[model samples]
Target: MKKPLVIAATLAVVLSLGLAACGGDDSSEETLSNSELIAQADQICTDYNEQLDTMNEEAALDENSSRQEIATYISDDLVPLYQEQVDELRSLNPNEEDAAAYNDIVDTLESELQVVEDDPEAAIDAEDP
Candidate 1:
């Protein structure tokens, strides 16, 4: 298996699936412009990346770490973090025209994340045929 730290990097890549950003106050129904949507999504992505960087440093896993250890880190630590990002993206209020496409992206992301969360071992198994 690869070093556990590499898992963090890979997770970052996977989690960065494009965000379809729409903006509104939590309690209000407001429509955001295209630029506003992009901006909100960009901010969320930025925050997610920063959080991942911190997590990677904190993990401090050496090359000798076991596959189980890596998998556990992914399941226990990384999965929840990425899940939060997905949830935040989902919360965005896309316009009616964009809503279907936005939902499709979110659904795809959730499915992909579920695959890793269900069997993190498969993630570390680079040698799998």
Candidate 2:
């Protein structure tokens, strides 16, 4: 269960960063350098990862916590956080050079988040080793 949760969290960071790396103003008149785009994206991922790490640590401190409780947290808390990140990523207009890759990552993250939102319990179950 923890494995799956960790994997999902890691993927969220990776995908968010990937999305960020390509983000910029959509205007043809304005474009960010690749380094600038990556830096911005990296910051978003850093913040997101920090929050996720804190949540995981807090959850770990509760040895008596039930699977249901974890599931509830993931669904009610974590999913919303991921959604916010995704929303932020979507708002960024990628540079022309990175648009295709950026859009692909954004789509993938949206799909992954939808699955977790729709059936958080199943997601938890799938993590069982």
Candidate 3:
């Protein structure tokens, strides 16, 4: 009887551990702690800086490759990244201003990206340089 009880206890422990693992890190844009969401917002700012650098360097390259690469980078990387970040940021509490700023960044950047994609020459002409 003692052996059976010990085995059951061990099984319960193992099951609990497995469940904990399955819960995973629920810290995306929509499900995160406050500090974690703030950290994620800061990370998105960093990513924006990186993308700016990439865009500047790409613009100077004078090749179709640069624009193509940037398009892929924007769609494959930046879009999803900021989307997730904004969702995560919105999940934060008592940070309405910061969340609004994050959402605005996401919207503005996405809109600009669509325009650039659809009308590269017009977008370039309209840009500040």
Candidate 4:
């Protein structure tokens, strides 16, 4: 994928994962303070970034890999990773103040991920208007 789109997709994954890691249980009346939520979310992103960095490093080692191979890897691996993040985010049941923004992010990421899953090569090759 183009650098910008790749960055955007990565960011979407980070944010979604952060939101997903927050919490999912509805029985608890306790809610995290905004600062606490931010801290937790940041930690989740940090961990995910580290994992992604490793994956990128491995991909980079294969100098002879074709665009199709890269796209296939992304579709097979990253798309499901993004989807897992989305699923986790949905389970969070975020508060009203953050729900709208979180939902928007999740929706955009899910749609983009779907496009990648359907046709990874086209997604990588697509140009911005």
Candidate 5:
């Protein structure tokens, strides 16, 4: 079965990914304004979504594809992509006004990704997934 877990996890990840629109670190010598931070985050989100869409196209799972195949796609493809997106977002410096919110978003995403990683099968079989 294609399974609801895959669909549900995908939805959760997409929603959480969108919230990754602001973050901060001390990497840059110059601080970015809130607007600039938002713009950069937006670009990151756009890039992530584009990449996800491309991966989905490339995966092209059929009805005959096994559950393990779907789970592997999530673990091998989705997880790494999400981790990269999170890392990119974390590298950006959000203004003080947006710092807390940005951290919360990243934290939530990390936790969600953990759940998906801990048990790909369970995630695929989640009742509410």
Candidate 6:
């Protein structure tokens, strides 16, 4: 019984240390391969595209897009930090399909932003003519 208890404690300590190493900031400063970076950008674009589609169909977006900090977060969190990665990926593979996808997403966001900026009240509600 005493031997088993000591073994269990040692196992627990080892497991905890392993977990701590894995849990630390998963975002690595290590450079991503071109393909990996493109994949990440593609996913972001896809998500942003779907979100804007929903917004357009339901309600026009206000400056803040119904309190969603998407633009805010993208600008501050994504762009500032990862813009270089995105640019690198684009420059490396300018003609990639994912690059076009990313551009479409950006265009959608811009259009939505314009709608909100041009007509704040109209954007807040979805009333078709």
Q: Score each candidate by Cα lDDT.
A: 0.71, 0.66, 0.40, 0.56, 0.69, 0.35
Against the hidden reference, what TM-scores do the models get?
0.84, 0.74, 0.37, 0.64, 0.78, 0.30
The best candidate in terms of lDDT: 1
Off by over 4 Å in 5: 2-26, 126-129
Candidate 3 has a TM-score of 0.37
Sort order, lDDT high to low: 1, 5, 2, 4, 3, 6
Model 3: how far residue 64 lies from native, Å: 13
Per-residue lDDT tens digits of candidate 2, residues 1-129? 455355455446545645544644323456556666666656666677788777777656243556687678778778887887777666666677876787788788888788878877665555432
lDDT of 3 by residue, 1-129 (tens): 122223222222322221211111234445444455455555544554465456445544333444444444444444454444345433443244344544454455455445544543332224222
Model 5 TM-score is 0.78
* Residue 112 miss distance in model 3 (angstroms): 2.5
Kindly indicate the candidate among 3 and 4 with the higher lDDT. Answer: 4
Q: Candidate 6 — which pairs collide?
A: none
The order of the candidates by TM-score, greatest first, is 1, 5, 2, 4, 3, 6
Steric clash pairs (candidate 3)? 29-87, 29-88
Where in model 1 is the C-alpha error above 4 Å? 20-27, 126-129
Model 1, residue 37: C-alpha shift (Å): 1.8
Model 6 agreement with the true structure over 1-129: per-residue lDDT tens digits: 122222222222222221211111113454444456445545544444454345434433234343233333333332322333223223333234344554454344344444444443332243321
**Candidate topping TM-score:** 1
Better of 5 and 6 by lDDT: 5
Q: Which stretches of candidate 4 lie over 4 Å from their true place?
A: 1-34, 61-63, 126-129
Q: For candidate 5, give the lDDT of residue 88.
A: 82
Q: Which 10-residue window in model 2 sums to the lowest lDDT?
A: 20-29
